[model samples]
Target: MSTSNGMRPETPETPDHESWWSRIGTLGQALTALTGLIVTVVPILVATGLPGQDSGNSNFSPTVVPTTSQPYTSPPSTTPPPQAEGINLTVSDQLTDGAEEEVIVITLEGSRVATLHATREQPVVSQRVTATRAGNYSYVVDAVMRWYDETGTEQVTNATGRGSVSIDDGTRLDVYVHEETDGISLSLESATQ
Candidate 1:
């Protein structure tokens, strides 16, 4: 008489195969380590101040872009051949000195009538445009400057001023623009200043 055994006899492990229990244990350990790493690194990333994280009450100021257009148009004169009409306008840039990266665009619309491109070092005067009518023409001068700030964002600033110039024969309408800490300032050559 012999005792009955339900299980089969054990055999040698396969040459290139891992044990199933051992593989499962290793995978579980690796998953746990990955979870631990994420837990450790996430706090560091947040605390060290990653970009695009807003606290809801941010003081960042939005950029300001300036636009220019001539709203007032004078009618062409029906004067005789002996009479001609037009205003001579000139723009002088007196901003900061030698700012190579700064791009300054000056737009003259209305009376003076010329768009001038200038920089800190170079000032430009536009060609004289013949006036269609003879009167005190009101014009708008807009100086827009663009530059790259330290944060790698393109920063734009604008200076604007309105002037009225009277022209009959050869009116040398001159305007000056300057950059100040508060903003831009403009002056007319005929101004009392």
Candidate 2:
């Protein structure tokens, strides 16, 4: 039926429902964009020492490595399994149960080895550290205690201990950190393999 204004009968507008092919085309475009992003990111990650980078260089100096050993075949177990030559250390903190402590960081660095963190906790500090070489090693144990002064503003008391340990092939030593009236004392219990 025609209106008095001379307009034709109108049909209701239909909302557009995307078709399967059109959806697939959109998915293909997204996939292409994602592939391009991944392609661009991988080289950057490799260059920046990220996931895709190699653990070490193949052309490392021959003068550095005097001996050649076979690669490790299996995964490492819980206990420190004995290797041909290495030092395995177990550090135990003998501080009083309720002693004041905040951030504690213990490190051992020297002689055929880099730095190793023994403890980074409170109340108690215990950890297992393994090093591939055996020689004289120096350690730096640092800790901080936080407390409120008379004015109620937070204040910190820091403590540091320096010591040395001797290690040999396939040696295992237990280091005890004992708190004394003056400061912390580091003593070696014994050595074993």
Candidate 3:
């Protein structure tokens, strides 16, 4: 009269598949604490607003725009063309008129001319002349007295005379003349533009 169902008495429970895995681990810890309280009250309700106040606001007003500019032009000027005139001559000393031949003639002003000759057995003579004209001009210097007076016929006049002129654009002018002892002196050192 005894028990023989594997010696009976042996019942420690918690089974039914551990109460269905303990109700699925308490429903995954209540859905991870409701997703961490909705990720910490949704940024504190978008940074304070519900009973935490100050939701940002400073009468906002800032906007300005306007700009335009364009206008200015000036440049054009040129001038040139005005110059042409020049004359030069020189003769200093030795143009005697004692016993014969002597002639010094220099005339310029578009008609340009130059001649010089001295003789009393060759006294002295020098000459240099040039000019074409471009504005104002007048020149004349004569010293003639070519003689043979004992009636062999032949005698010239202008024993001594002087004159001058200038105002050129063809460069410059330089004049010099000297033959004293009964006259003939003229000078106008230099002139240019």
Per-prediction TM-score, please? 0.39, 0.35, 0.25
Better of 1 and 2 by lDDT: 2
Candidate achieving the largest lDDT: 2
Off by over 4 Å in 2: 1-85, 96-98, 110-122, 147-155, 168-193
- Segments of candidate 1 deviating more than 4 angstroms: 1-112, 120-122, 147-155, 178-182, 190-193
Local accuracy of candidate 3 as per-residue lDDT tens digits, 100-132: 776666565435476767787777666555555
* Each prediction's number of clashing residue pairs: 3, 0, 5
Candidate 2's residue-wise lDDT over 2-86, tens digit each?
Answer: 8889898789865566655566797887898899999999888776666665747666564443345865455466876776655
Best by TM-score: 1
Model 1, residue 136: C-alpha shift (Å):
1.6
User: Each candidate's lDDT (Cα)?
Assistant: 0.57, 0.59, 0.57
**Candidate 3 lDDT:** 0.57
Q: How many clashes does the backbone of model 3 have? A: 5
